[model samples]
Target: MIGMSLLVRLALLLPPNVPQIPVLCYHQIRDWRPKDRTADKAYIMPPATFRLHMKMLADSGYHAILPDELYAHLTKGTPLPSKPVMLTFDDTDGDQYSIARPEMAKYGFKGVYFIVFNNINKNKYYMSRAQIRQLSDEGHVIACHTLTHPNIRKLKGSDWAAELDVPARKLELLTGKPVRYFAYPFGIWDQQILPELSRYGYLAAFQLDEPRDSAKPLLTVRRVIDDGRWDTSTLDRYLKHGFGHK
Candidate 1:
């Protein structure tokens, strides 16, 4: 395993030519009902639409890669499959297990799920511990989304441990794997927290639609939210334009 110091050094030395893989971040995977607010619908993907997106990726010959593969490609200049993409789910929603999981399976795709520790098993809407473990068992990467999905910029003192350390330890115990990746709550991050993430053994952290920090690109790995509102064509355009794909 690379130490934190070496990790930072390598990240800084990364070549400009390193491929920018498109990572799609998702939240809920159920239909948006009348009660769902218009603003909130962006995070609530319908089951049918999710299936269509998966099919599109499959037909387009896009292979879903996991974080370890992404890490290796970014840090060690390892080659990836042509048209590699990463599907990542955040917030531990139960529908991900019930709906998204099987749909992705149809295309032989796997995802990285970032769990909000406080929300797990809190109710029917959230994923339970057993389900999380099942994801790990079935070859999905399970990562942290903090203890309560707080905006990390406001954290202070022991707030760091309460949100990051405790939850990460619990996730590691649940999945029986090292929790080495994180997705910022609401895609918010700050430079000060980068050292804290490193201290806790995180090799990389993700944020939504933000420019990566040049000095610490690993800490600010960028992701684009898979908006529930987009059709397959629109998604394709975004993928191409957003990641600079031809």
Candidate 2:
């Protein structure tokens, strides 16, 4: 731990030539209900608050980059904007399309949406195929969340491949674009699943909090979860000092 601290401090002493894009993970965006008992409420951002976040990012000169642009910067030595960040949404929720999309567009930002195949037609809460295509056509990324939103760490080899590959194929068919990125369901993943992801031609995968292997940046990219707790000042602190854990 001491060595790691020294390295971080040493790195901070130097000018940053490479991009350090903070990937923000979000779930739902909707109006808050006072009496709501949903367990996923913490993942919901009120529409008005959501608008504030987008405005703050735009006003602060943060550039919202796409997954392919991020991948190129990380692996292919591509140049990024002066300030770059990735905004991502998980689950196939209707609110993401109806609420977040327009809000993001207001700031001239694009987002990556991870979808759960099973929820499309079965659950009313999820986005439909037509809606998903609409978002993709509008220049947002449609990536794989999972086929059924299962915990990949608990699945065997075949089941893991099915969960990763099936959704990639399904999304590609729907969007007519390659599905190159993935977000683990519930932010749960393990290094053992990397081979399966690679076999499916995934360029990168995202997990919340500390990455499984810090050296493998693409395979285990880190993200910060936002549940509507951030104001502009808090967001500034995050940008300057990180989440403050070390």
Candidate 3:
């Protein structure tokens, strides 16, 4: 441990460069799920594995910045030091409120949680209002996941306005803090429809695409992750070296 500390201490003396933020995207926290059968996909990570990943980041000398902070750095062209990262969760599942939040708190990092407002009480699979508030009070961003998880590209005019704004307003009513960010339902916010995002007062939006190597596009920022099928070595490689794998 002393040698590892000495190594990090030495590395910190290096020069500044672009912050390669591997914004890790996650959902549904339960017992471990094996990598899916169809392809090399990055999706649902179990709560325990998520803990290991956070510990790994901390040990490797990475800082877990929030989505808004990352946006500010990228937009302002401010480079993060070596191994900068932002951890994020979407859908605002109840399990995230129950399991993931505590584990992440243990690691001293808070994630940006995008939620579907309509399911706060109507559905068992999603988070309830009280649970959502507790998470916000704990310091995580409970941003919007739209009212009903629609494709923003397909909708226009009032539909677009409603999809984007109402949930944010709902979150505001619930938590008393203004909602400042958003995430597309399936990483499907196309370029032609970006103006509506501004109409609803969003400062930044995220997409669960590949790792962002260069500067990010305004509407869609990129991220990478260590999901199922990615063992510890693969996870380390993806975070420290490669772009991303499916």
Per-model TM values vs. the true structure: 0.94, 0.86, 0.80
What clash count goes with each model?
Answer: 0, 0, 1
Candidate 2 Cα misplacement greater than 4 A, ranges: 1-19, 35-41, 243-246
Clashing pairs in 3: 40-246
lDDT of 3 by residue, 141-194 (tens): 888889999877678668976788778888999998888778888776565555
Between prediction 1 and prediction 3, the one with superior TM-score is 1
lDDT by residue (tens digit), candidate 1, 155-220: 999998888889989998998998889999999998889878877778889988877776677778
Q: Give the TM-score comparing model 2 with the true structure, all chains together.
A: 0.86
**Two-way TM-score contest, 2 vs 3, winner:** 2
Q: Which lDDT value does model 1 have at 163?
A: 88
lDDT of each structure? 0.88, 0.77, 0.69
Write model 2 residue lDDT over 1-246, tens digit each, in one string: 012233322322222233357888888787768775565566888788888888888999999999889876665567989778789999888889889999898888999998888878667777999999999999999999989998787888589767988878888899998887899888887777876766566777888887345444566677887657677778766765663321
User: Residue 79's C-alpha lDDT in candidate 3?
Assistant: 62
Candidate 1 C-alpha RMSD relative to the actual structure: 2.1
Worst 10 residues of 3 by lDDT: 1-10
